[model samples]
Target: MGIDFLHKAYVRPSTYTTCIILTFMDQITYYGGLFFMTWATFERHLIIFHSAVFNTKRGRILFHYLPILSIFVYITLYYISVDFFYPCENHFNYLAFWCGFICYMNLPIPTLLGIELIAHQVVPMILIGIFSLALFLRVIFSRQRLRQSIEWKKYRRMIIQLLSTSTIYLIFTTPFSLNPIAQAVGLPPMFTTPVYAKVSTYWTFGVPICVPFVILLSLPKVKEKFKPLLKICGLGRVVPTR
Candidate 1:
């Protein structure tokens, strides 16, 4: 999209190649992140509120490995079916943020608005909020349970991890996702199009760029990795080997 900004590729012609790359990347990062993060939020709930779900090998496979595998397979198939093999012909705007999902516009309004907009995008977004809030509530209530004497340290780490990562979704990605959905539901492009165009430059790919950094920053191991680098640069004192 940097190239798009340099020269309005979204609105320009002969940009099919750029469009394909951007569309593929945008869907994989945005949509793929939605599912991956939603599952991560739910898994945190299980880890904190129902630790026994991971106590056994079977439990780990069922609750952990299987879902991850399922998401990978599902995301792969879903995008390939929708973007690659769908009856619609390619109409790339390589300079655009997603290189255009205009092909989706070719579908019946019901299928496009209902299935693509509602099922794929909205459901996952709703699940994100629900799971996040549900986990928080579970954390609060579990504190009073004798059986759930899970350490505050564990709870604290999980809480911070979720909150920190979710910050990107709230501030950056939500608008990006909502703009299209709102437009689909009859929100005038006259109102949203200009604002989104300006905002999309910063917000379009920013979440994907920032999220991994945020997640890494929330992790203790990432901090440890930084300390060594900092020390070598004379920015911090070295830690003695334990």
Candidate 2:
């Protein structure tokens, strides 16, 4: 009875308030979902790419360096944006607000927001689309070769995990990508469209929580395995498995 009373008094309201705040925050920040999706993608890519290489000290150092390097590059680009591509005062319209919301959240603000319509939205979509297309072509053309060299059963789980992750990431990002083009041509706000705002906001919260759950489900042993992997990669001392 005490536990139940405490739960009712504290937990429920806290959870409800958190949900409302997150929804409002997401609504105000156009690219919040996309930025999170990009971060997730980058983390997953690092894990996959360095899984083999992380066995060595030099490789582990390099693995650590990549994210740092990415940060430096982002900073440099921000500097360039501030110095060179300053947007006109009249450019910050309703469309620009949405784009700016996305830009400011992910980037340093004002400067990055200035060029975000082109650099963040359009360029990224084009690059991601091209990369995805190339991956698809490579998969289709190389299937026979892969069949001979790859261990189908062992890799099957990893492949499914990767595809599921990619699909979810793309779903979250696609709307933000397309929103720029739509806004450029003077379409209504994506949220203002029937049912889209609510649906998209739900997705914003759902996708991150969903991906971790999916990873847990598909790789049932991930939590157990990851501790050992971290130790093996010299990230920390191994915790003993029970």
Candidate 3:
């Protein structure tokens, strides 16, 4: 995000090739996060409620590994086809963010992208909310029943990760997702469009900013991971305080 910002804010008359790189990356990172996180949130159900399904090798592959791999492959192939192979003459606006436009917009196939927008962006937002809340409720019910279905301490991070992820997506991504839907329906372009234009700029920074910290904090022994890098940079030794 920072690299793209620098390219836009500093570099003048950006080339079409650079625009392709910046725009493709911007689309993939932002949408990819939404898709991956949505699946992760839903996968929490399988990890908790459907543990037996993962007991077999086929089950593990079918339930867990395959979906993740599919998402990765799909995101890569879909965007590569769109940005690189799709034949559309692009007019680069060096003054605008990401050269000011998506190529599909110039073509008549933008409605197709809108369907994808809803499928990839809006649907994921809904699923994330539904499943995140369901996860909390189920855990609490299991605790009350005293079933001890799973060891809470063993999987404490899973719950924390789900809740944190839910919070991040619901708060940060909703406005960006809504921008397209708002325009798709009957409405004036100027009403909420300008606000989203500015929001869109900072939206580039939003998830990348929150996700790294969320991930690092969720990891086991995260300080151990960072200490060597800190030492390399001549920061003071990381020590435990009494």
Q: Pick the candidate with the highest lDDT.
A: 3
Span of 10 residues, lowest total lDDT, candidate 3: 4-13
Write model 1 residue lDDT over 1-242, tens digit each, in one string: 65555566454444666566556666666777878888998899788768898999999999999999998888778776776667778765554545545586556556743466566566777788888888777767777784447787757876987967766666675665565566667776753576674675457567678878877887898888998888789999657898
Model 3 residue runs over 4 Å out of place are: 1-13, 106-110, 187-191, 223-242
Candidates 2 and 3 compared: the better one by TM-score is 3
1 versus 3: better lDDT goes to: 3
Model 2 TM-score, all chains together: 0.46
* Model 3 lDDT tens row, 1-242: 44655655733445777888877887777778888888888888888777799999999999889998888889888988888887776787777666777677555434757787788887898899998999889888886574566777866787897798678878877776676676677455653466675675466466668877887878889957877887989895768899
Prediction RMSDs, each to the true structure: 5.4, 12.5, 4.8
lDDT-sorted candidate list, best first: 3, 1, 2
TM-score of each: 0.75, 0.46, 0.81
lDDT of 3 at 128: 90
Pick the TM-score winner.
3
Q: What C-alpha lDDT, on a 0 to 100 scale, does residue 198 get in candidate 2?
A: 37
For model 2, the superposed segments whose C-alpha errors exceed 4 Å read 1-114, 121-133, 152-154, 185-202, 220-242
How far residue 54's Cα lies from its native spot in candidate 3, in Å, is 1.6
